[model samples]
Target: MSTLSDYLNEHLPDGWQKPQLVEALSGTLDRATVYRYLAGSHPRSPAESVLEAFAKVLPGVTVVELRAAANLSAGAEEPWVPPVEANRLSHAQRRALESFIKATVGPIDDGDEPNHRQPSVDLQPAAPALTEQERAEVESYVQRLYASGRKDLADRVASSLVNNPSIEPATRPADA
Candidate 1:
């Protein structure tokens, strides 16, 4: 169970240091960022762009392998599926589930009473719709992927945007 850092150190090119690797990445990432990732101290998962850049500079490394090394699932290509239990939930059942979850986890704001006030469970709000400009930005990024000869990736991105209607693009204002 070697960690990603171990793999990177073992396969580093002769005479290459962290600074050299940063330079090889064309400064898209900094030495400290690279070190943090290698040290597994990053607060969040490394962005796909960062992983792709590392794959480009590191010999015999692929983005898939890098993702796996970071403990990410390799089956991102699989179709999305809702849980069977989720698909069968009625409105009452859903409410019951939400109540159960809230009861188990307690409330987000417990500082007010500490033990006196009952835990409050609020329903999460719907996600905001993407503005026209944001839609254009995503389209532009997908186009760039196509231009870079990564049509498969471009298609996947496009498909994800289309399939997830909660993030549908908003209609522009008439005056604007």
Candidate 2:
């Protein structure tokens, strides 16, 4: 089984350092979290989130590698990138995806600055809320689904609640 530690050790070679890794790593990860993934001292196998973050910055690392490391790929074929045409991203969609990636993951140092031409975005603050009664009702629905041996249904409800764009993930109720 390939360990996350092995992946880190292999990738961080060629004079790579922790500070460089931290700066290069995308997502909301902190320095302490990076330290927790150190390969030199007390390395921890990265969680799915850590692996996903690594995928954004590290070349040749992707969802395939993530699954492989977890032994979930089940003898998968060699990794490959889909052709641009295969992706079917329209010109507008491509630009929008580039903009979103730059905003979230920053630049990839591919020898040039990003085009920086994108459609304007209307930033809006969403304050989604569910009344106590509504929360209780949802919770009851989930529990009933689980009790009836329909955990998949309960998980779907919980996933929808957690993934709703209107609600901030941090503000979700504990039961959700």
Candidate 3:
């Protein structure tokens, strides 16, 4: 997926400053508006309407499509430019997006081998290890998730650990 920065830099017309663009959208919108808009806050109501003005300023297409595309692509390490919208996605396009995000942000070494996996995010060096109290708090949170039958969130947590670079992975040899 094109980084949000790329979209802002390339799509916004030349000679118009980002602040100017923000001003055009809403006179009261501040610097943070430009920052968050480019940083990829998904559209909410009036902001959604403003995207149309953006398309006009940029020219040619409907803003809803642009916003939807950006919404799906936000925060991804790669550019996932779908030539068509969700409704128009072919089986192939669907598979590609799923594969892309799963590979980029989902679990590591999930059996698609031969391509070395580098973490999309480089986390800061670890701080001191978790305190016993911190561990207890985390354990309680996990237990609460399980007790509430939020298995999907539990699965996401497990996947995050599997992909995390902070913890060295435990390895086991294959057995006959």
Candidate 4:
């Protein structure tokens, strides 16, 4: 069985029963569909929405982990840098980094945001709680960014989390 199937089969009974989970979804999915998913009768991976809803109420599991298990996620290939921090870097620093990247990665797309990016106040709100796994991933990636001398990107990704506790998504790793 797939890891997602095994996780569902094992954990479903621990916290939520079949009928109970169907109802808990608030009709997001039909009873028969849940049963089929539970029974491992479905061929495709569960929809992101289904897994997301399950992760919402499930205690320990995370949507990121679930998506990985379902073979939906490609796994982290490169560091997931933050864009909002571009504004914080001095123009010289931005140019230096861009030159380094351009030499290494050919050319950045024309649509890429330049040094002057949108402010944090302009960012859209994200409220769902970040799972432990997601938090760990963010911390690990941020550390990698710092170690690689990309403090600007690191600061951008993590500064929002530590600098402001009130920003909903910044408080957590962001909605899984």
Candidate 4 lDDT, tens digit per residue, 90-168?
5555554544332332211223222122111122222233344444445565665677676777767665344224433
User: Which residue pairs in model 3 clash with each other?
Assistant: 1-78, 1-79, 1-80, 2-79
What RMSD, rounded to one decimal, does every model reach? 18.1, 17.5, 14.2, 18.1
Model 3 is weakest, by summed lDDT over 10 consecutive residues, at 106-115
C-alpha lDDT of all candidate models, in order: 0.53, 0.47, 0.44, 0.53
TM-score, one value per model: 0.41, 0.34, 0.31, 0.40
**After superposition, which runs of candidate 4 have C-alpha atoms over 4 Å from their true positions?**
13-15, 74-176
Using lDDT as the measure, what is the rank order of every candidate, best first?
Answer: 1, 4, 2, 3
After superposing candidate 1 on the true structure, give the runs of residues whose Cα lies further than 4 Å from its correct spot. Answer: 75-176
> Per-residue lDDT for 59-170 in model 1, tens only?
9877666555544333332334657857665565455434433333332222332222211223221222334445555556555556667677666655534523656532
Clash count for each candidate, listed in order shown: 0, 0, 4, 0
CA shift at 29, candidate 1, in angstroms?
0.9
10 residues in a row with least lDDT, candidate 4 = 114-123
The prediction achieving the highest TM-score against the true structure is 1
Please list all clashing residue pairs in model 1, or write none if there are none.
none
Pick the lDDT winner.
1
Better of 3 and 4 by lDDT: 4
